[model samples]
Target: MKIIRSRDFTGSHAWEALDIASMNGITTRLHWTDQPYRWHVNDGEEVFVVLDGEIQMRYRENGQEQVAVLKVGDIFYASVGTEHVAHPLGVARVLVVESKGSV
Candidate 1:
């Protein structure tokens, strides 16, 4: 087992992730970002948890785009075929749980 301090983490680039665990084709990772991510659809389900700072989560539903502001401790769930992207307000740390190679 390993202990991680999410607030103390940083990445070389936006959306760079540190792998935390993988079990039964599911992967858990920590991501650091200060920029926005491109919109994309996941092949499977995804669980996004904010660890530090804030994020503006944009998603497309029924051909419409919507946004949600997520703060620390907030969780966002994305099911298969859900097109979404994340825009961090500044520097943010996030924990993401999803199927292996789902991106």
Candidate 2:
């Protein structure tokens, strides 16, 4: 058993992550970043939760770009075929759950 503090997390580089678990082929991770992630669609689904700081989640919908500002405690669900990316406003800690080995 481990007690984790989201606000106290850090990474060696942008989007660096600490693996939390892998169950049923789904991987859970804690990520720390101050940079934007590349746009990509998950093979299955993705759950993005902000633990600290904020982020602008940008995605393509109906051929148009959309943005959602996510604060701490906010959760964003990306269904399959959703082309999206995350831009951290600052040092942000995020919890991400997705299929194992997914980019």
Best by lDDT: 1
TM-score of each: 0.97, 0.97
* lDDT per residue (tens digit) for residues 1-103 in model 2: 7878887888989999999999999999999999999999999999999999999999999999999999999999999999999999988999999999988
- Regions of candidate 1 where Cα sits further than 4 Å from its true position: none
- Clashing pairs for model 1 are none
The TM-score between candidate 2 and the true structure equals 0.97
lDDT of 2 at 40: 97
- Residues 17-77 of candidate 1 have per-residue lDDT tens digits of 9999999999999999999999999889999999999999999999999999999999999
lDDT of 2 at 91: 88
Q: What overall lDDT, based on C-alpha atoms, would model 1 receive against the true structure?
A: 0.96
Model 1 quality (TM-score):
0.97
Which residue ranges in model 2 land beyond 4 Å of their true spot?
none
Count clashes in each candidate, considering only residues at least 3 apart in sequence or on different chains. 0, 0
- In model 1, the Cα lDDT at residue 20 comes to 99
| Whole-model lDDT per candidate | 0.96, 0.95
Note each model's CA RMSD in angstroms: 0.6, 0.6
